[model samples]
Target: MHKRAQVSVEYMAMVGLSLAAFFVIWLYVNSSNASIQQDLKVGFGKQVVTRLADAVNLVSVQGSPAKIFVEVNNPEGVVAASPSSNSSCSNVEIMLVMTAPDGKTTEVFSPVAANVSGDLSFLVGNPGLRRIQVEAVDFFGSPCVMLSG
Candidate 1:
């Protein structure tokens, strides 16, 4: 009877240890997955901003009355009030607001090389297919590029 009880106890101990080990591994994998997802979201946001900037630059270089249409995808977690107004052509930049798995929020900004400004309200905080209009215009006596949905 004593020998049988000893064997059973050892088996139970081994099983417990295996369970603990598997649990730990599972936790690590879950956390890593969340981190990867966060990075991908941020990357997608940057790509969107870059795409729009490219179109604006193209229109600006072409001069006034120049216009073009570009399609872009607005990633999730973008903020409506984001990308504050630009007072001058040099300060023009678009922003992407992102949220992480841990409930942390981040803002990513991409600058447009040429003078850029316009009503991007429809694009902010809205995730959908966006067809943006880019045009060169004369604003406040300065040449600039305008973006509209």
Candidate 2:
């Protein structure tokens, strides 16, 4: 009877160890997954902003009334697309933000392009496929691109 009891205790100990190992691996996988997700979100944001800049520049050069509609895949999480806060085309920068796996948020200044104007509010925080209208317009007596959805 004592031998049988010893065997049962050993089995339980082994099961506990197995569970601990599984939990460690699960934590690692989840952390890695969060990092991967953040990277993909950044890539998606870059693609969307770049396309917006291209459309804006195209319409601006073609003159007023020129417009183009673009469809883009919007990623989940924090998202923002706006003209640089005085960020210039020569500088090639715009500002946005996202969270990291470590629960630390890194502030980023990186969404942008063209002498663009108008409301980019439509593109902010709306996930899934987004359709945006890029039109050429006059801003303060100068040629500018207007973004809308």
Candidate with best lDDT: 1
Candidate 1 per-residue C-alpha lDDT over 1-149 given as tens digits, one digit per residue, 9 for 90 to 100: 99999999999999999999999999999989988877877887888788888888788888999999989877777664223354545546766777776777887777777777776767666887789888898888889887778
Model 2's alpha-carbon lDDT is 0.67
lDDT (0-100) at residue 79 of candidate 2? 44
Per-residue lDDT, model 1, residue 87, is 53
Return the TM-score for each candidate structure.
0.78, 0.71
Judged by whole-model lDDT over C-alpha atoms, candidate 1 comes out at: 0.78
Candidate 2 colliding pairs? 94-109, 94-110, 94-111, 95-109, 95-110, 95-111
- Predicted candidate 2 versus true structure: per-residue lDDT over 61-119, tens digit per residue: 78888989989776665445555332222323433454556666544444344566555
Candidate 1, residue 25: the lDDT equals: 100
